[model samples]
Target: MIHVAIIGQGLVALHFEVGLEKLKNNEIPDYGVPLRNWLPYKYDDIEIVASYDVDESKVGKTVYELAKRDYPGNHIPGSLKDIVVSRGIHLNSMKGLPFKARGREEDKGIEAAINELVDEWRSLNIDVLINIMTTEPVEPVGNAGEIERRALNGDLTASQTYAYAATLYSAKYRPVAFVNAIPSPIANDPGFIKLCSERRCVVFGDDGSTGATPFTADLLEHMYERNRKVIDIAQFNIGGNTDFLALNLPERNIMKKKTKSAIVEDILGYDAPNYIRPTGYLEPLGDKKFVAMIVEYYSFGEFKDEFYVVMRINDSPALAGLLVDLSRIGRIALDRQAYGSIYEVNAFYMKRPGPPGSKAVSKYHAFQGLLNWLGISDPRMQQARR
Candidate 1:
C-alpha cells in the first residue's frame, strides 16, 4: 500500500480523503453527482495514512471527526470514521487569516508552532506533502533596500513559510512532492523552483481548479472552428468564503487576477473585454461560487451573436478529487525517480498553470504523458472524451 500524508486539514484535504476512500473500495458507483464525478482516477492501492492541521479544534481528531464536526458542507454520501488528524506545526502562514479556534491560548504566535511541525514532518516518514493552505499576495516591500531589510529581519508571511517548508523537506526527506493547491508564489517563484530542483523534490501547481474557463475556451474554440467573428468576452466571479475574502484584499489577489486573465488571453490569442476577476464577497454563499460569463461576436453581416453562461459550484469539492489525484501522482513521480515540477499533471489539472504567457494543454494529453512515463494506464482516460 502507498502511504500518503496530507499537510493541510482544510476543504481540499477533506476532498482528498473522500477520494482516497473511494479508491480503496475499488468500485465507483455513480451517485449522479455533477462536478464531483469529474475526478479521473480511483486507485485501490493508495491510502491516506496521516494528516496534519494546526487548528486546535481539528488536531488529535479522526478523519470521521473532521468530516462530521469541521466540514458540514461536504455531501460525500457516507460516514468517515477511520481517518485521524494529528497536530500540525502552526506557521506564520495562518496569521491575519480569519479562522475559528477552540481555546484562547491556541491563538498565539506561529514561529514555534511551525518549527515543531517541521520536526514532526521529518520524523513521521510522510511520503507526500500537499500544501493546501490559503495563499496571500506578496506585498511590495517598496524597493530592493526595503526587501533586503525585511529579509534580514525574517518577516514571516504565507509565501515565505511555504518556501521554508519546501526547502526544509528537500534537505531531509526522500524527494517529497509538494503540491501548491492555492495561488501561492512558492510554486511560481524562481528561487523556490530552483530549490526544489536542486533538492530533487517535485513541485506542482500555483492554482487548483477552473470552474468556467475550460467551458469558455471550448466555446471560443467552437466559434473559431465555425469561422465566426469574435469580438469581446466578459467573465465575473462571486463567492462567500475565504477565497472571496482573499480576492477582496488587493494584496492577496494580484497573482490570482493575472492567472485567471492569462487563461483566456493565452487560449484566444487576443484580449477580450474580459472582466475576469472576483466581483464581490457574499456571506450567504459560504464556500459556494457563482461565475457568469458573456461572449459577444460579429458573425453574419450586421448580426451580433452573444452567448451567456452561468456556473454555480461548491469550490472546495470541485477541486478535491483533482487534488487527491495530484498527491497520488506526486508519490508516483517520486517512486519513478522523477524530479522538478510535474508539468504534465499540473498543466492538465491546474487552473493557472506554468509560467505566465504559456498556452494551456488539454488534461487528456497530460494524463496520457504521465501514464506513459509511469507505465500505468488509467481506465477513465482511455474512455471517450467528455
Candidate 2:
C-alpha cells in the first residue's frame, strides 16, 4: 500500500482524502483520473496517512471535519477521521493574504520543525508526500547545496522545506516520492531534483494540470498537428477557492502565469503572444470555477480563424482524482528506484514538468510517453487491437 501525507490541507487535499476513500470503497468511479486502474497499483493500494496545514483554524482539525465543512454533496468517509491536520512549515507563504497562519517553526527552530516532520513521516511510513500548497512566489535554486542551506535557515518557501524534509526522510529511512501538486518550482528546480536523486527520493511536480490547463494543452496540440499558425492565445480562470484568493496577490499570480504561459512556446516550437492565468475570484462560485479561452490562428489562403471556449469546472475534485493516480505511481517509482524528478510522470500531470528547462509537450503526447515509461498499454487500446 502507498501511504500518503499531504502538505497543504486545503480544498484539493481534502477532496483527495475523501474522494480516495470513496473510490476505494467502490462508492465512486474514477472519472477524472487519467491513468486510472492501468498502473500496477490500484486505488485500493492508496491511503491517506497524514495531512498538514498552517491555518490557525485548520491546524488541529480532522480530515473528516474539514471535508464535512467544505466538501460538497455528502457521505464524507469516517475513515478520514483517523488522519488529523497537523501544523506545517509556514515560511510566510500566506503573507499578504487574509489568513491567520503559523508553523511549528514559529515556536521551534527551522531545524526542529523539519526534523519533527521527518519523524512524523517516519512513524506513519509515508510513501508519498503531496505538496499542494497555495501558490507561493519562489524561484529555482540551481545548486543543491544552496537548497540544503536555505532549508536549514528557514529561507526557503514552505513547499521547498517540505521537499527537503522528504529528502531527509528518504535518506534516513526508505526511498520515497515528493509529489509537488502546486505551482512552486520543486520539480522545476534542478537543485531539488539533485537533492532528491542523492537522497533516493522521487519528485513529481511543479503544478497539477487540472480544469482548463490540460484542455488548452490538448487544443494546442490539435492546432499544431494541423499546422495551424497560431496568432495568439488568451485564457483565464476565476474561482472562489482559497487558491484563487491566494493568486489574487500579484506575486503568487505571477507564478501561475509563468507555468501557464510556458506551454505555448514549448508546444508550438515558437513563442506566441498569450495571456493565461487566474483572473479573479468569485466567492459564490465555491469549488466550481469559470474558465474562458480564445485562440486565434491563421489557416490556408491567409484566412484568420479563432477558437473560443468557456467552461465551469469543479477544480479541486478534478485535481483530487489526479492525485489518486499519482499516489499509486509514487509507490511504483520507489519500487523501480527512480529517484529525482521524473519527467514522464510530470509531463502529463503537471503544468510545467521539471528537472529545469524541460520542454512542455501536449497532453496527448505526454500520455503516450507516460504509458511508455511504465511499459504498459491503455486497456481501451488493447481491447480495440484485439
Candidate 3:
C-alpha cells in the first residue's frame, strides 16, 4: 500500500493513472490487496492518491474532471471520480532548455512559484514526484554551481530550480524516489546523482521511451545480424504536445539529439548520415506521435535497397505501461533499501541507460530483467529474453 503522488497533471500523468488502474485490478490470491490498482487497494487505503498541477484549469479539479477535459483518450480506463487534483507549487517549471513558449508571458516570477509549490508538496506528504514533463538539457557539470546560486537567489524560475531542488530534496528524503520520465538533466546531473546515493533514494532515467527509435534500432540490429550494410537511416517525428513543442528550441535538444543518434549508431556499429531531428509540431494531433523513418542499405555486390517505416502511436498510452511499471518498481526499490542508480531496473526501464562506460543493453533485455526482478513472470518479458 505505497501511497503515490504525481507532480504533473499533463498527458503523461493521465497515462500513469491508467497504469495504476491496471495494477490495482491485477488481483493475486493472498497478496492482501493489489499494489497497482488506481483506487487505493482498499477504501481509505490511500494507495494511488492525489495529483498536483499548476495549470489554472486543472487546479482544484478532480482527477476525473481533468481527465475528461484534457485527455479524452481515456488512457486510464475507469473514471477517476474520487481522485482530487490539488494545486501544485508551480516552481515556474519549463519544459525544454532555452525555453520558448508561443503565447505565455515570460515574466511569471519563479522563486515565488517554487517556494509555494515546495510548501504544498511538503504539506501533502508526497512520497513520489514523477516528472513527466518535456526534455530539457541541464547545464554542463561545471555550470551547475552558478545555476544553483541563481535558483536559490530568485534569479531563476521555478522550472529551472526544479531540477536542482528536486535532486537535493530527493537525496535528503529517505524512502522517497524521484523518477524522471523525460530526458532532463536532473536525472543525469553529477551533484544530483551523488545526493541520491547519499540519501538512498532512487533516481531513474535519461530516456527510455522507445516508441519509434528503439523499434528502428531493433530492425537495424536484425538486418546487421545478416551482414546487411546500412548506408543511411533517417527518422522524422512530428507531434503537437509539449514534448514536441520543446524540441523547437535547439538548446533543449542538444542532449536529446546526442542520445538518439548514439542509440542508433551503437546498434548499427556505424555512423548514420541520414539521422534527422523532430521536425515540426502540429497542434491538431494533440498527444499523438507520428514517426517516419527511411533506412537505406546496400546488400550483396552493387545492390541497393531501402526500407521505410512509419509508426503512429498514442504517446501517453505507449509510455503509460512503462511508467506504471517504473512507479511500482520505485516503491519496491524503496522497500528494499535500494540506492544510487538501481542499474538492474534503470537499464531495463530507461532510454540512455547505465553509468558511463557500461555496455548498452537492449530495451527488451531490460524489460525482461525488470519482470524477473519484480517476480512478475509476465510472458511478454520471458519471450523477450528468448
Q: lDDT of each prediction vs. the true structure?
A: 0.62, 0.90, 0.62
Q: Encode model 3's per-residue lDDT on 1-386: one tens digit a residue.
A: 55667766778787567545644565222121222343212322335576766566676777777777776654445547767876554433554433322212224455555555555556555566577655655553424466667766655433345545554555444356677666655555565566556666677766655577567656766776778888888888889887788777777766567656666666667676866567778988887888998988888895999988887877776666666556666666777777656666666656666443343455666656765666666655469999
Q: Among these predicted structures, which one has the highest lDDT? A: 2
Scored against the true structure, residue 349 in model 1 reaches a CA lDDT of: 66
List clash counts for every candidate, in order.
2, 0, 11
Question: Model 1: per-residue lDDT, tens digit, 1-386?
Answer: 45566767876677667755664564454232222323333455456667766666687778777776656444452535665777554434455567643321144444454455556666766566776666566632323234324433446454455445655666766567777777765455555556666777777776775576556656766666676766877888888866677677776667577666666555556666667777788978877889998888888785898988988977777677666567567777777667666666666666666432336644444556656665665667568564
Candidate 1 ranges beyond 4 A from true positions = 26-42, 73-97, 100-115, 139-156, 223-229, 300-303, 355-357, 362-386
Model 2: worst 10 consecutive residues (lDDT sum): 32-41
Cα error, candidate 3, residue 362 (Å):
2.5
Give, for candidate 3, the lowest lDDT window spanning 10 residues: 27-36
Candidate 3 Cα outliers beyond 4 Å, as residue runs: 22-46, 73-82, 87-125, 140-151, 154-160, 163-173, 253-255, 354-359, 369-386
Cα RMSD of all models vs. native, in order, equals 5.0, 1.0, 5.6
Poorest lDDT segment (10 consecutive residues) of candidate 1: 30-39
User: What lDDT tens digits, residue by residue, belong to model 2 across residues 27-83?
Assistant: 988888888778878888887888899998898989989988878879999999998
